[model samples]
Every structure is written in C-alpha cells, then in structure tokens.
Target chain A: MILKKLFSRRKEEYWWMTIAVPLVAILLALITGVIFIKATGRSPLKAYKLLFGSSGLFPSPYWKNHFAEMLLSSSMFISTGLAFSIAFKGGLFSIGAEGQFIVGGIVAAYFGYAEPFAGLPTILHLIIIFIMAMAAGGIWGAIAGWLKTKKGIHEVITTIMLNWIALYLIEDWLVTGPMKANISTGISGTPYISATAKLPNILPGTRLNISFIIIAAAVFFTWFLLYRTTIGFEIRAMGYTLVFGMEAPKASGVNVNRRIIQTMFISGAVASLGGSFIVLGILFQYPPVFEGGYGFDGIAVALIGQNEPVGIFLAGILIGALRTGATSVQLAHIPKTFPSIIEGLIVAFIALQELIRYLIMKLIVPKRSKSD
Target chain B: MDNTSLLNSSLTQTMDYAAPILFAALGGVMSENAGVFNIALEGIMRFAAFFGVWGAYISGTPWIGLLWGIGIGIVIGSLHAYITVKWAGDQIVSGVAINVMSMGIITYLLELIFKTTGYSPPVPYFGSSVNRIHIVFIENIPFLGAFSNLTILVWFAIILTVLMHFMLYRTVFGLRIRSVGENPYAAETLGINVVRIKWFAVIMGSIFAAFGGMALSLGTLSSFTNAMANGKGFIGLAAMIFGKWTPFGAMAASLLFASAQVIQLLLQVAASGFAKLIPLGFYLALPYILTIGALIGVVGRAVPPAADGEPYKKE
Candidate 1:
C-alpha cells in the first residue's frame, strides 16, 4: 500500500493536476526569478520582456531566426532527455551520459574526418558514422552496467567517475595528441568533416537541419517502445518493483541483470545521438572546449517531463527556448544564467510535489466537505 | 633536487590537497550515516566558496568570511532538510536539484556582486604566512617532516576526522543517528525523534562541507573561481564509499586519492622522460579511476546504512 502510494497515481487526483502542477511550478519559478532580477537593481519587467522577445515567443523582427536556434538547441535536449528517461525506466541512473556523448562525438568525428571514408556516398557515410557513434556509446555505458552486475558497483558513482575520465581523455589526449588537425590554426579543434558527412539543412539560410526530424522520430520511437511494447512493460516493472525489493521480480524469473545492461546500452546510444547531432548538424567539427552541461541539463528535462517521452519533448523545447532567450537578458545587464536559475527553481519545486499536493488537497477538501 | 626531496615535496602537496577532500568526505560520512544521501556536497561547497570570498571581500576579514560561508551552508542544509525530511521528498532528486540550483544562483550572484563571469578578485585569506604554523623539530626530520609546514585548515581537518570518529562511535546522539538511519521506524518506537536527528545530521554535515570550501577559497587560494570546487565534492563521495563510510576510512581514502593528484603534479614538474611517455589525461584521471576500482573491489565488504535513500515517514 505504501509502495503504491509512492509510485502509483492517486485516485483522487484530477487529470488537470498534471498540467496544473508544472504550470504552477513554472509560474513560481518565474516569480522567484523576477524577485532576483529586482534585487540586482535590474528592471524585472524589462528583463523578462527582453527574454521573451529574444526567444521569439513574443512578436519580433528576428523571431524566425531565434526560433530556428531554439529548435536546434531543443533537439539535443530531447535526445539526451530520452537517453536519461530510458535508463531511469529500467531502475538505473546513468549519469555518465555526458561521457558517452563526448566519446560518441569523438568517434563520429574520427569516422567523418578520416580520409579512408571520404569516397563514400553521403547517405552511406552518415549511416556509418551514426552507427559507430552509437556503438561506441553503447560500449561505454555497458561498462557501467557490467560493473553494476559483476562487481556490485552503483551506476551513480561509476557514471560520475566515467564522466571526468572521459572529459580529461578527450580534452587532454585525443583532441590534442593523437587526433590533432594537421593544419595548425588559432582555434583548437578537429578539421571539419567532409561535406558529404554533414547533416543537410532543411531550412534555407537557417541552422534548422535534419536533426529536428530525427529528434521528433526518436521521441515517437521512445514513446512507442515504452508504452506500446512488452519489453517496455518489463522495464517499467523492473524499475517500480526494484524499489520495493528483489523478491517479486526474482520469483518471476526475470533476468534483471541482463535487462539492466541492455537498458543502459540503449540509454547511452540515445545520448550518443545527441552528440552526433551537435557534431554533424551544428559544429561540423569537435572543438577543444565544445558545449558542456547539456548532459546535466537533460536530467532536469527528464525530471520536469516526469520521464515521459512526449512530456520530455515539450520540456526540452521549454528549456531550449529559455536558454536561447536568456542570452538576451544580458541586454538588461542580467546574466545569461538567469534562465538556469529558473530551471533549477522548477526542478526544486518539482521535488516538493508532495508539499504542493498537500496544499492543493487542503484547499479542495474543505470545499468538498462543505458541499456534502 | 634529489629523488628523496622530490618525493617529500610531493607528499607535502598531497597532504595539502587531501585536507579539502577529507573535510568534504567527513561531511558525507556524517550525513550518510544519518541516512541522508548528500550528493549536494558539491553544490554546498560551491555555494560556500562563493560566499566565503564575498564575505572576506566585503568585511576585510577571512574569519568573517568563513562564518558567512558556514551560515549559508546552514541555511541551505535547513532548506534541504525541510524539503526531504519534512515533506518526504526523494533524497537523490533533492540533492540534484540543490546542485543545479547552486550553480545557477552562484553564477547569477557572482555577476551581480563581482561584475565578472570567471572569478572573484583576491580577498583576505585565512592562515597567512605568520599565522601558518611550522614545526622546527618536524621540519628537521627527513621524509616524514613534509607535514610540518601547513595551513590551519589542514590541522583542523585532521582533528575533525578523529573527532568525528569518536562522535559517530561513542556518543548517545551518535547511537540515535545510527539507529535512525538503520531503521527509522524502530528508532521512532524507541522514542527517538528521527526528523530532528536527520535535521541535525544534515545541517552539521553542511557546516563541515562549508569548511571544505573555505579550505579552497581561503586556505589554498585567496579568490573564488567559477566551478572551483570542480569534482572534489564527488571525489569526497567516492572517498566516503572507499572508506566503508567510516570517518577514519574516508580520511584515509581522501589521502590516497590526493596522493594520486600529487603524483600527477609532481610528474608535470619533475620533467621525467617517463612522464612524457604517459598522457597527461591518464594522470588527471588517476584518482577517479582508482576510486572506481576501489568501489568495485570493496562492494561486498563496505556497506551503507540500511535506509540510506529512503525518506522517513511517521505513521
């Protein structure tokens, strides 16, 4: 009964609660953000107006270009959010997605930039790079899974450690030592991938590319896999049941260990796709200090989305828009990290769902009793 | 320099580096021993470091800065305790939220206060040359004398480790905390206030973690840099695990990890041919790699408190 209360939906809950809860959380976060802006002696209204104006939510002359940039950013978030959600469904916290993402990008860049693959057709080249990236990420994630089962190591610790190791290895060794571009230039980054390996832009004169469609398809595939298939059922079962204890699943003869490894491999592969998008669609070459903190941001996305694929898609866009908009807050002398504070506040509020629910219950119960 | 002197110098560096990790790991032990999984150690330390610098810069005193840092830690700890203990929130999620929030809030505050994105200006630092104690007798000794000249924080960290070992194993409050962590229901039945104990444990742990941050901003450097805590908070968690969740064990584990870091630094400075043969990344990643290895090897032997991550409920 206690477990059910913890995991299962409350019977008295209304459908609007889902939408209302997140809406309330976002509203509160924005209010808190406004207070912060005011405390810093900035005009909160101007800051927010600039934020919305730049993000293209409000009518603006350059809204189209900003919207495209938002889409590009959201694509990575969507992919990484799905990656985290997949492992989360299987009762694993694969925080090492950042490492997997980095390794995957490195491998894809290697395959794309190598002279041996230059002669291949564009379609064939892209296919090979994607597969190799996923494969590398899968292997990376599988190590964490293997340690969990074989050595009883927790994925949290292993993944966190792996993240640092991956960062150092990529930054210090691979990019600088073995794979340094032949042409020494001002910037420290790999040579651009062959034109054939690049992701085609769907929109003319904008950053919008094939990644948008790919991320949309991934979202659909994740939803279909989790809610419409038997494997998904087993994975969800494993996640929820493991919370209570091992007796129920063990008695049912499920090979929990194998499932964990498989789930993590899939998780890592999905996260790798996010990195591939950045390399192929955005950067076209891996820079020495390429964008980071996206893997960590994905955790916030997954949590706000309630680990659901469709919800994650919306949350990803919301975060993407906020991040893109935050750049304009600097116009009002506010920091770009302003949106991050809002995002953090939302996550913190989400963590306090019980408190929110209790408050709502208190407000509703007295009214119902009076009516009775 | 001779090889022996080089080794001694490296060992001294190791002791210096170990102080911060040791403080943070001891904090982790305290909180985890009381059943709160404090992944927010990193965030807490970062927040404290920023506040430490801010306070010292404003007050022209490192002692005031240290107090300000601990005060912020206590506030954050209380907030975490209220959310997790009072509201029965998920511990890990709460921790992650705290970390995320700290990064954003600290960054925003940094820009607001310092008008810079990267780091703060130099501030009044704790343990200046005059205040730093150097034992003449110990300094005269050969290899083991490397620990003679040290910052006050290093000695404080050492003393706290021993103090914590006693606090966890010898006191009535310690027994209650252990009982609350192992089985809150039984502890409650025995008239122990699980909520109060957890609140005390978490707040105390946060204060200790603040000291770790102070060690970085005041003891080691006089300024706060963006993400200065780096991954030391996580390393402290690894140390807590590597030590089998014991205070002494965590301190020892921190020393081991710090030694790896010191060796890496020594390699860079010594300019040995062997150092050139190995990639810098290998040395940079050595401590984390060793941590993972230790966790895997010690899995069966080292165990956490029974109800580590679970939120306590009163029926």
Candidate 2:
C-alpha cells in the first residue's frame, strides 16, 4: 500500500516539474538579458519591446509575420527536439540529428520532385516521402549506433563524423551538382518540389501549414511509444544504466545493444521528419544553403524541457519565439546576436543549475528564511 | 596531371593542415589522459582564435595574441574543470554547454569589438613570410623540400608531439596521470592527488587547444573569421581515437587525415577531369568517410581511458 502511494505521488510530481524547468530557465535567461542590455547603457525594457512585439510577455502578436515564422519554426524545433529526447532516453548522445535532418530533407526533396512514385494520390505521395526520408535518416543514425554497440566506438564522435559526411556529400555536392535546378537563372539548389507534394497552408495569410498538425502527431506518437510500450520499458531500463552502472540493465534481460540501435533509429527518423516538414511545409524545395541550426537547438530545447514530449513541445515554441524576436532586434538598435547570448546563457545555466540553485539558496535566501 | 607537383603539394601541405589538428589532438590526449572528458576543444579554439586576433590587433604582435589566447584558454579550461571535476557534474552536458555558449558569446563580442559580424581585421601574424623559418637548403631535396618555409607553430606541434610522447611514456608522473585516468581510486590509493592531476591535465589541454586556435588565425589566415576553427577540433578528437589515445599515434593519425585533406585539394586542381567525372563531394567527404571506416574496422574497438567520462567522488 505504501509503495503504491509513493509511485502515485511520484507521477503527480512530474506535472509540476514539466513546467518548472523551462520556467526557471526562461526566467534566468530573461534576467541575464536584462542585465546585459542595462550594462550596454540601454533601457532593457525598450529593447525588449522591440524584441518581442507586444512585449507584455506571453509571446504575442499572432497576427504578424513574425508569429507565423515562430509557429513554423516551433513545429521544426519540436520535431528535432523529439529526436534528441528519445535518443537521450535510450542513453545515446545522438548529435547525428543534424545530419539526419539534412539527409531526410534531401531524400524528401528527391521524392518530392521525382516521378517514380508519381500519379499516386496526394496522401499516398506524402506517405511515400515520409517513409523514404525517415528511412534515410534511420540508416544514417544506425551507422553510429552500430559502431557504438559492436565496436565500442563512441557514438558522439561517429555521429559528428556522419554530420560532416552529410554536409559534404548531400548538401554541398549532390544538391549543387546533379540535383541543381536547370533554370538558367543560375541558382544552386534542387528543383522546386511538385505543388501536389507541398503542404497547403492552414493559417490564412500566414505560412503556417499542415506541419503544425503533423508535428503534434509526432509528439503524441513519441510520448505514447516511450510511456506506453514494452520497447520503451527496455529503452528506459538501458537509460537507467547511467545510474546503475550498466549491470542492472544487462542483468534485467534488456538487450542493450539492440536497444541502442532501435532507439537511435527512431530518433533519427523523427529528426528526418523535421527536415521533411521544412521541405514539404515551408521551403517546398531544398536550397543550397540551409544553415538552419534546428538540430543544435533541439539539444537546448530537450534539456530545457526536461525531455518530456509535451514539455519539449512548449519549449520549442518558447525558443522559436526567441529566434523570431532575435531577427527583429535590429529595430530597437540592438544587435540581433543579443538574443543568441540569452539562449547560450540559458544552456550554460541549466548545465550548472544545481550549483546556481545552491548558491542562491545559501548566499541570498538564507537570512530571509532564518528570520521567518 | 602534373604528378610531381601534386605529390609535392600533398606532402608539404600535409603538415600545414596537420599542425593545427596535431595541436588539438594533443590537447585531447592530455585531458582524456587524466580521465576528464574534455570535448570543449572546439569551443576553446573558437574563443582563443578571436581573442588572439584582438590581442594581435591591439599590440601589433602575434606573440602577444598567443599570450591572450592562453589566458582565455586558462579561464575556459578552469570553468570546465570546475563544473565537471569540482562540482562532479555531467561531463557531456558541461562540454555541450561550453560549446553552445562559445558560439553566441564569440559572435556577440565580435560584433561589439570589430563592428562587423563577418571577419576580424587582419593583424600581425606568424603566417607571414617574415616569421617563417625557411629551410633554404631543403629546397634542393626531393620530398624533404616540403618541410621548408614553415611557421614556428608547425615546429611547436612536432616538438610537442615528441615531448608528449616522452613525458607520457618515460616518466613517473606520467604513470600517475595515466593511472588516474584508468582508475582514480587506484591512483588515490597510491597517494596521487586525483584532483590536482586532473586540474593540470585539463588546463594544459586547453592551452594546447589555444595554440591550435592561434595556428588558424595567427598562423594561417592572419585574421579570424566567425568560421575560424571549423570542425578542426572535432577532427582532432577523431584523430585521438584513431591513434588509440597516444601522443605519437595521434601525430601519425593527424598526418594521415591531413594528407587526405591535401589530396582532395590536389585532385580538385590538378585532376580536374577526374574531379568532374566523379564529384567534388567525394574528395571533400573523404576524411570523414575514412574516419567512419577506420572506426568500424581498421582500428578495431578503440577503448577510452577506463574511467573516461565519469565524475569521480571520494568515499
């Protein structure tokens, strides 16, 4: 009876925790941004007003172009964020998400323009693109996973290597060479994908499209897979090896090696879907230069969101808003890079959050608490 | 095909590319040798490259810039050590945090100082002709001519490799350092101060990485771009693994990777016909492809230092 009560209470605690981590991080980031602006001899309030329109703070101005950009990017961020969170849950540091994202985009772009699966129904065409792109990403991710499980090679190094490989082979070479649009305009990018393959805009007068709905499904699918399945149980069991030292999981009959590869495959597929979203929903074509650091942003988002699927969805929107605000910081006569400083600071703070909380409680709050 | 010129370029330019990678790889060797999972070499190099340029621009000396780079490396390294070592935090998280912070912080400072986001102003740098140690007589020699007219930084890399090899393999203190990396508890029992060794190793690792950053800005380009030290640090990390975590082994691996890079350029320029028939991406992606292949089979299970990324705590 006591054990049941304890388990039930633990479940309840996560509801509050889902909100707390991002709240504290966002709060700390805003405070730091304010100090930085103040140090530069500018009114923090004025700069912020120019930053987030209707700067009253709930991430507003949904009718504007910026809000549309934020919503679109949030969809992208949430997708990649799911990738990282799933991989982390399986005890893999999969930085290959960037590469997987790129691969997925290219593969989707290829299928988007290619006529091999042509004349099919629109929904069928979309399904084919999703499968092909996600499979490409999965295969790419599995390389690193296989290296880790079979050869004891570090996944981080291999994944980084794979990222560079994708950059050179796919992004730089193939896209600019064979896949280049034949238009005499001399632009270096893949041909525009078919209109039938493109996701129709859902939000009238804004770029927001079917990606918003699709990404929501992805989050729900990942949450269900992680929390409501036996495979997820095995994956979580492997993850706990970080604390239990790899022995408990091994002894508990979890196939550690298989779990690593499976988890990374799922992670890679999700990241690739992010690429598909951009290609299908936003760009409708693969450009020569996609410096979208969405994969890296996923790392920050996953950490800030405490790795819950729903939490990641919220964190993605928050970060996407910051990114939109950053692009417009120039109107306030502040450098756009300023918002990036806050993003980086938030990551840095979370990495050492334990120490920060300790310092605050002991150094700043002790006197007031003692009086109470 | 201009075969001789291609061969000459590949042989000579190898060290030029290899020198920075060698410096960064040695940095990996130092820190991981002490069991600190220091993957912040890329971030440290980024910071140092910019600071070095600023220092040189102000003082009109690459040497002073190098000093500034070292100073910042010390601060960054100490920050890393504090979080991962002193605080017993997650090593990967700390490293990732530092890497993330460096990207924004450097860009912010670059805009603040230079009033430009693209690249810094050209400054006094060792890569200039006046500073190079020209081995004039070697020009008459066949392959040996490739080593002529190199920067002092290149020589530093070569010398440091030898010194690291000797220190790591031939000394008692080196044994203790390796022992700590392998098992800090065992080292502590043997009276070695695990924290002190870790501190020394992590700090020195940063200093070496700072030198690599200097090689990029102060040695090669004489100016720091926002893209300075692009992926060199990670390549160095790959070199450390490919070398099986030894000084001389890392030097060899750096040379091989550098040669691959040089061959790509040679193929692009000299073998244009071949380049067109195939694709430029094949050459550009060669090094990374080679890394994946090497990790898969050639190296055959390169194990890290036993206690590599663990945050050790005393009982």
Q: Rate the local accuracy (lDDT) of all candidates.
A: 0.84, 0.82
How far off is residue A205 in model 1, in Å? 2.6
**DockQ for all models, in order?**
0.65, 0.55
- The model with the greatest DockQ is 1
Stretch of 10 with least lDDT, candidate 1 chain A: A3-12
- Candidate 2 backbone collisions, by pair: none
What value of lDDT does candidate 2 attain over all alpha carbons? 0.82
For residues A271-369, could you state the per-residue lDDT of candidate 2 as single tens digits? 999899899888888999887678877887787666778778887888777777776676665777676677766766666655665555566566867
**Pairs of residues at least 3 apart in sequence or in different chains that clash in candidate 1:** none
Give one digit per residue, the lDDT tens place, for model 1 in A253-355: 8787887888888888888888898999888888888678788888888888778787789889988999889889899988888888888888878878788
Minimal lDDT window, size 10, model 2 chain B? B1-10
Q: Highest TM-score: give the candidate number.
A: 1
Report the C-alpha lDDT of model 2 over B144-169, residue by residue, as the tens digit. 77678788999899999999988888
